[model samples]
Target: MARMRIQDIAAEAAVSPSTVSKFINGHYDAMSASTRSRIAEIIERTGYRPSSVARNLRLDRSRMIGVILADIRNPYSSAMLGELADRSAAAGYTLTCAISGNNPSKEAEAVMRLAEAGADGLIVNTCGGNDELLADTCDRAPVVLLDRDVPGASIDLVTSDNGCLVAALLQEVMRDGVDACWLLDEHNDASSVRRERTATFERGLRSACARGGCIALARNACAAAAQLTKMSCSSGGSPIGLIAINGLVFERLVEALAVAGIDVPGAARIATIDEYPWNRVLFGGVTTAAQDIAGLAAAALELLIERIERGRGPCGSRRRIEIPGNIIARRSTRTDSGPTTTTPQPLRAHR
Candidate 1:
């Protein structure tokens, strides 16, 4: 038996091949509901799969967008990607994703591959040290930075206000009467967001210490949790509080704390900058600053569409949009006055 083509479906539906193609590509404007239904039914009956290569050649567009993430294992990154995909689909575009695994070289290679694949635009949660390659790509195509920044690349960016997030988390720790505080550092190059968060954390710590407190830094989440455990075990006195910079760091902290058999809020306190569904259920909810994933997705998509429409290279006129994150007060690192119980809810509800 021979395979059916789009022309067969178009003929059955009594529509032009271009009209059927436009409908298949999700361009519903100017298409009547009846026409859409007829075309959809015919295509389904015919088992027609539009050839993406032919469609691209006909329309001069791949009708696809690319998204790159530093690590897809992180729940936050995955959530953002999901939201971005939905928004892009609604806008008549498909999304292709690549995971860099936090490696700069891999990130660069992924960017080049996506560009070569004829992605109309790119949304990147960049790995550090790919700024030059990113700049070169932006020079050729529309690029939007998501969740992280690339220095010296003048492109539209959508990210949470990490500075305010860390500052607010530290404020809660101070209010809880934590005598000493520690930061779990995940070492990456000084991206704009990371630099801002570090500076804000230091400033907040300085202000808190003037009122009588101390802050320390750990190499990473595992080390920070370990040090906190050792300090709490050896001293047998006041409790110490620790702050994880992101959801990935928080997971490592939980693993380290569980290995050491440390009871959160009893032996020590814990807080972090981001929260997902598991955080609410696993540890009686962790106090965290939550980013607006939906808003971030909308903003990124808007910028990308604008850039594509303008056909402009990455330049000084592009805006850096920093969306504010909200503080979720949970039991893990909160003071005695903090909420005693928090019901586990879908993270999507918070958005």
Candidate 2:
């Protein structure tokens, strides 16, 4: 069968191709209800699918954006990407995703590929080491950094407030009067988010020490687990609390703790930065700083559109949007309260 075209649909409906084009583009302000109904019926009967490529070319724009993520394996990054796609589609734009796998060379290559493919804009969750390449890319297209920031890059950014999130989590741990606190990270120099998280953890620890609480930092999950085991064995059983920087760090910590036969709220307490469905099911529940996924998506899209419409030139001023996350209280950190079950909630997405 021959592929249907806009002219074919217009001819069958007895309307001009321009009218059909306007209807397809959703410009129905001055269109009559009868005409609109006729076009809709004709389109359904003919099973016509509009050519996005042709329409985009006619507009002299690609109407497509690229989203470069540091690691698609991370639950937080995955959730944010899903929200961005939904919100971008609602705004009549399409999204293409690229994963850098936390490598600087891979990240630079992804940026170049997306630009070569004629993407109108880019939203990136940076891998923390692509400063020069990212700066150059911003000169070629509108780029919005998300979740992580690249230093010396003069692009708009959307991320959660790191300082506030850590402070809130620390407040809960200190209030419970845990014996010792530990901060766990997979590697020290992975991404900007992890760096900021580590800095905040140190500041929180200083504050906790001022209040007379013991605190320490672990280079890797294995080291953290070793320390937990040593403390548990030496003290003949004392309560130790740990704050895992992110989901990956949390997983390693859980595995190590399980291997050592550590009990939650009995031998140790756990808190993490981001929470997903599995976290809730694992130890009954875990406390976390849930990132504002929808807010970040909305901010990223608005920034990208603003830059694209502003035309070719340096941004008038650097814009940084910090979306505040919420602290989810659960059974992992609860001492006197025993294990309690809470209904599993679906993650929120951008509209």
Candidate 3:
């Protein structure tokens, strides 16, 4: 609803334009007491307010936070959104959320637009581009990096513990007697999360005797997988197991395996980096390092709000927080037996 205006109040009160302006602008010293009282009564009855005056009165407050998600298609992103919404509402702030479709340029546009529209703070799933713009924007308002991060940018970050998680998962696969393992990572520059995952996997490998073979799923995941296997067998080689980088990659691996008539954990054992709600029901279940979506979401919201409300100064120096997740062992990574009864628990891979 439109707010009451000073003109509406003056017309109703039958007063000169200057008289009302003086009264509204708090210049009542020259006005008679009766006239001042009349204007006040009219304003009270009509609920009149000057938009510009009101805006100037509370220039420090907007009560709105903006969110720039890298990709809404991610199930983790969806879960984080719901959690962020709940926390924002509880903290008396509304949210303006936008998706970047994992495009850096679109991410920059969304961030700039939201800030221009007066968002008090921002939570960004950065597409790993526009570092300069992101840093500059952070100077205006608190920018919390969610899930993914930008290189050489000092900003508050909340992400899963991909390092420890990956290392542990790889150790477990080794103990399971898998001769060779290949990690199917979608090549991209927009995701630091993927980079971290890949680095941890490489460190764990340490130039093992057995390596992996598979390449180019851009044209078609299934076709690419078919070609990868055909080439491997032709060259007298095969991957004993495969580790999918994330859910999308995992889905592609599943599709490829199905099309090539390769039984998971049989023809080729399988494990993935992300665990979804549907993981348990798929392919006799899948082994995955589960991300703590709720924990990450809550941490991101809390950290950004703290910086916004508590003041962004020396104490608010950019902080990076990593929350660990469970390594859920499902049948997809089994080496000997078939799929068994599934339970939600963290696998004992540390020992």
Candidate 4:
């Protein structure tokens, strides 16, 4: 149905535009009960909606928040979205989500579309490569980044403490007495968090063993399995530890290990950066560092709403907040049949 304007609504209801305006703004003191009912029926029948642009122009606010995710298929993104929606609703704001599918151009388009649609603020999980566009967008509406950062852009960021989490995970894995560590990841040029974690893993692995490196992931699960088999055979009979970069990588790695018929924590040890529901049972509880999705969502929404209420500030001044994650140790990374152990880290903030 075509969206009817206030003038059209007024004409159909046989009321003046002023009366319709007052009704929309909830000032019903002057209108009779019959007139109010008639206007409501007209609005419902016509499917009329007040123009957000016009409302924002007049009231200087939209009471709406926009969320742009690089890919909602990621469990992290989906979970965080739910938290953001609930929190925004409680704060009297509506949320609209756009999926970028990890495309930089699509991400830039989403930014423009959300801003033009009159979002009071934006929470973006960027796919990178749009630093300039994001910086320009900050001038029009507040933009708070989630899970990623653009070094060229001075924007607020809320993400997990990847360095500390990776360090802790590595420390635990090294305690298992593995001969080498290998990080399996897809091409992560567009993801800042993945890149940072990869670097941290490499640094920690080399410092501990001097026998590990980052390995590229293959799209085909069977091919990945062959790669793992080759790595295992070349490890000189010493057990090597494998680290999956994220949830997607974790799934593929698990399938590959299964295909290769390699026993967990026996032929090889496995751990991942992101957690999943099956992490506990699938292959006997894969060890993982679970990102604090709830905390990240709350912090991002709080930062964005706080900025919106305080008005836009100087573009040069920015904030970066990192919520710590939990490293859960399980059978995947240990040879013992003991219970799970969780190590909670501390939160950190950077300007």
Candidate 5:
């Protein structure tokens, strides 16, 4: 029995070593479909998987990446980290993941510890309020900003393009016959400039829809569903629509709705940004603006690897990549059977 190698696989597949390397690294944009298929077949037939020890030795590098999360328990963060790790493994890199539990000080501490341990590169979904420290760390090594973005920091970012997506979501909801809508969120979360900018868009759009104006509303997210249910009742006692600011709020709203025994697409047409595996099946699929998780993960890795292997990037240009979100309509936000635009639209569709 002998060992298999990338060069051997490259030869077997009749492709250049670099091309095989790209395939292995999950960089297939430049590779043709036939070539990709052929490589995939050869790899499958040969049971060829990269050897980490050999890879590290050949590259003469650690081949380890650091991933810092604001809250690992958050579905969004967990999903992204899983995708990032899967992509990293495909590229022969190992990951060291740290969770900050949404604490700024803990985030800073975790990042510092990871850096001190000598990770080849770093990717972070930052907790708010640690700009200067992160900037300093970026000066020393390649850093990729994931999910959350910092203001005035020169780093590559991969996140959803929120402006148009939020507008589109609102349009779809309006078209679905939601007369009124409420933006549900904790409101006190310390969003970076990026998150705040998106929130501003959501607030503005929601305000315009609700009162023909955007006014600051006191946010009590945990109890939003009950309050909105109370406020939305018409002269005939009907339910209005609710939009969760993100998945976190969505969960809270769902719980509130359940405890209150109100039905979705019945009492309220519900939707939110961010996606998770359970979401598609939850309540016959929940309406959401789901971002391309795999694409975001690959793009983040590409930026990190470029910096790690190529030294400094272009003289002065910083990379900001925004992937658009997709509209997912489900039972949660569908038009009720009777009069599409009038009355409470009671949660009749599901129950």
Candidate 6:
């Protein structure tokens, strides 16, 4: 029982060693269909597994991609990670994942550890506070940011278009007798996607001759709940719209509304960004803006692979990709008008 190398596999397929190596590494541009099939058949029949370590040593690439998520408990994070894993494997790469739990210190540690481990590149859903470390790491490896973007980091970013979707949702809510809207967010940090959505909501309210404000649910859900209650009461019985920044905040707002005996579409209307399974079942199907999880994963992978295959470009010319999300109008924000659902659209990448 001896090990088979690339030369043996190439000999059986009647191809050169470089061709077999290219096949293993997924470089099929110059390869023909019949040649690919013959090589694949031989490799499958011989059970020839390529040695990743040896290949990496020769190629100077680990074939390992590092992924950092702020929190995996959130449905969007889990879904996006699953998509990334599947796509990475098909592209002949493995993924090493880390959860920062939204702690800056933990996130910094993960970034350094991954870089030291010789990861070919990194796809980070940053929690902020690591701009300096992230920027410095760019000199060592290619980095593609996911979800939240970090300022001053010159890294390629792939994120959902928050402002446009929020404006569309606000327009729908205003038609449902919602004179005042409240933006509920768990954090006010730069890492939070709430920043863009909150700004868009405010502008939408002002344009429509409506009023609204932001409530910081930062580390104190109870205080936020009380503030919401007070705001609702002082509105003089006018219907108020409540917009949760993400799924985590949406869950808390739902619980708080139930405890306060407030009814959806009756006492106050409620909706949120980031669609989840629970959202479709709660409160007669909650209204939501669903980000294209698949698109985000694919775009991020494309950017990382490009940088890995090619060399780094000018930092000032870094790419920033924004994928549009769909708005699902359900009963939560329902009025006399019928429910509607918007179709998901293609993405736009900017530099």
Q: Residue-wise lDDT of candidate 2 within 71-184, one digit each (tens)?
A: 888788888888999999998888999999988789899999999999999998888777887788888888989978877667778887777777677656555657556666
In the range 1-351, model 1's lDDT, one tens digit per residue, is: 577777777788898888987898899999999999999888787677777777677767788899999888778888898899899999979999999998989999999999999999899998778888888898888999997877666877898767667777776655554666667656554556667777777777687662222234354656665666676665346667777777776777787787677888767677877667776766777877778889899999999988886786438787888777777777877645554323222222221
TM-score, cand. 5: 0.73
lDDT by residue (242-332, candidate 5, tens digit) is 6666767677777777666677667667677777776777667677777777888989998898888987465355688876557776667
TM-score of each: 0.76, 0.79, 0.76, 0.82, 0.73, 0.86
Candidate ordering by lDDT (highest first)? 4, 6, 2, 1, 3, 5
TM-score winner: 6
Q: Count the backbone clashes (under 3 Å) in each candidate.
A: 0, 0, 0, 0, 6, 0
Candidate 6, 30-89: lDDT as tens digits: 999999999999888888898878978998999999999999977889999999999999
The reply for model 5, stretches above 4 Å from the true place, is 1-60, 193-209, 212-225, 234-239, 336-351
Candidate 4, residues 252-320, lDDT tens digits: the string is 898898889988888888888877788888667888888888899999999999999897688767888
Task: Tell how far residue 292 is off in model 2, in angstroms.
Answer: 1.7
* Residue 5 of model 3, lDDT score: 70
Candidate 4 lDDT score at position 237: 84
Whole-model Cα lDDT per candidate? 0.76, 0.77, 0.74, 0.85, 0.71, 0.84
Candidate 4: pairs in clash: none
Clashes in model 1: which pairs? Answer: none
How well does candidate 6 match the true structure in TM-score terms?
Answer: 0.86
Task: Flag the better candidate by TM-score, 1 or 6.
Answer: 6
